[model samples]
Target: MKSQGGHFNKIIINRILATFLLMFVAIGIAMFLGIPNPETLLLIVLVMITSIFGMESGIVSIVMLVLYVMYFYSAEHSFLLYNRGTELAKVIVTALCSLICLLFCSLVIHKRLSKR
Candidate 1:
């Protein structure tokens, strides 16, 4: 039983790490490709992560992405984007979409698991 619990913990850790890795890799590729808007790519990645790893990992990924945007994408590296409404809008839209995706994926997963 103890070993089973430890194995489950390891799986959780791996999923969390994978979530971050996927986000970073997507961002890197978008930057390399000179994509004007990486937020769309990130949203798709978020949905995929949520569907595969479940809501907990998805929420962590969302928070990390939000912090990244707040720091790097905002004006003066701060969340005070008083003059940059577009950046603020992007963040808001992305966060809301990710949350919707997360809820949908969670429901689908719960239904499938319950059926089994």
Candidate 2:
């Protein structure tokens, strides 16, 4: 599906790398503004994974979500929540972060294609 008009692998690789870079930038911004939570780290990683590869990208997104939840549940006193990661608030926050990552990559691809 990626070869009809242009090279897909390069686009994907570029997007993935750019996505990670954006995450670090986003995280750095959040940190500078005082997010004060480990969830920020998980969020940056999760968002990067979800965005870099689409929905069917792989099992990575699911696995990471589970782990984040697990850690949230076991810890009970994280800066983001109090008792594991099952809280609705935390899930929503994480999802929003992922969406941002998705948007960033989407824009990059869009710009590249548009330039052609």
Candidate 3:
């Protein structure tokens, strides 16, 4: 049981590291490609991470993505800029959509695994 717990911790750490690495790589690629809408790419990355690493990682990814956009992409490069109603709305909507996608993916994965 002790060994099982250690193994589970190791797996969780690996997934978290992988999620962070993937997020940075996606951001780099978006910057390199000069994508007009980098959030779209980030959203795809969020979905992929959620599907592969499960909801915990998905939630982390969503928070990271939102913070990245709010800080790095904002005109003032600060999270406090959300005082603008439209900006706040966009972030809320994006986060909600990411959560919906994560839930849908988790349900599909659960159903598939339960069948086998």
Candidate 4:
């Protein structure tokens, strides 16, 4: 039989995987549509989806999304984008927006969950 801790860990893992997958799909869609500012809205959506499972998952999803966006920008620009101040600022803004959305959504989720 599985211990309670093991089951909890499994849920956490599953949350991470699900968040990652959803973010991947969102990113892909944005890219396919040539949306340069997709994160502005996509981050909110991603956080909302992850927060359904738990606050931690919502936080993790935003963190992972930020990292992925950073890497993706570097890759798409052949690493030259990092040398531009405006581009770097855009990345920072994106990360901040994502974090802010995650915090707001997670708090709402926490409050809802606690009421049960």
Query: How should the candidates be ordered by TM-score, best one leading?
Result: 3, 1, 4, 2
**Which candidate number has the best TM-score?**
3
lDDT for model 2, on a 0 to 1 scale?
0.54
In the order shown, the candidates' Cα RMSDs to the true structure are 2.0, 7.6, 2.1, 2.5
- Residue 25 deviation, candidate 3, in Å? 1.1
lDDT tens readout by residue for model 3, 1-116: 56988998999989988999999899889878988667789999999998899877887788888776666445576776755677777777777887788788888888988999
Candidate 1 weakest ten by summed lDDT? 64-73
Off by over 4 Å in 3: 82-84
Candidate 1 clashing pairs? none
Best by lDDT: 3
Cα-lDDT of candidate 3: 0.81
Model 1 spans with C-alpha error above 4 angstroms: none
Order by lDDT, highest first: 3, 1, 4, 2
Q: Across residues 90-116, which tens digit of lDDT does each residue of candidate 2 receive?
A: 666665655565566667756776999
What is the Cα-based lDDT of residue 46 in candidate 3?
A: 92
Give model 3 RMSD, 1 decimal: 2.1
In model 4, where is the ten-residue run with the lowest total lDDT?
72-81
lDDT string for model 1 (2-116, tens) is 7888998999999999888888887778768877776677778888898899888899778866666665567786776635787788778777877887898899999999999
* lDDT-best of 1 and 2: 1
Per-residue C-alpha lDDT of model 4 across residues 1-116, encoded as one tens digit per residue: 98999999998899878877877787778778887776665776666775676666677667767765676566365644575677677678888887777777777877887999
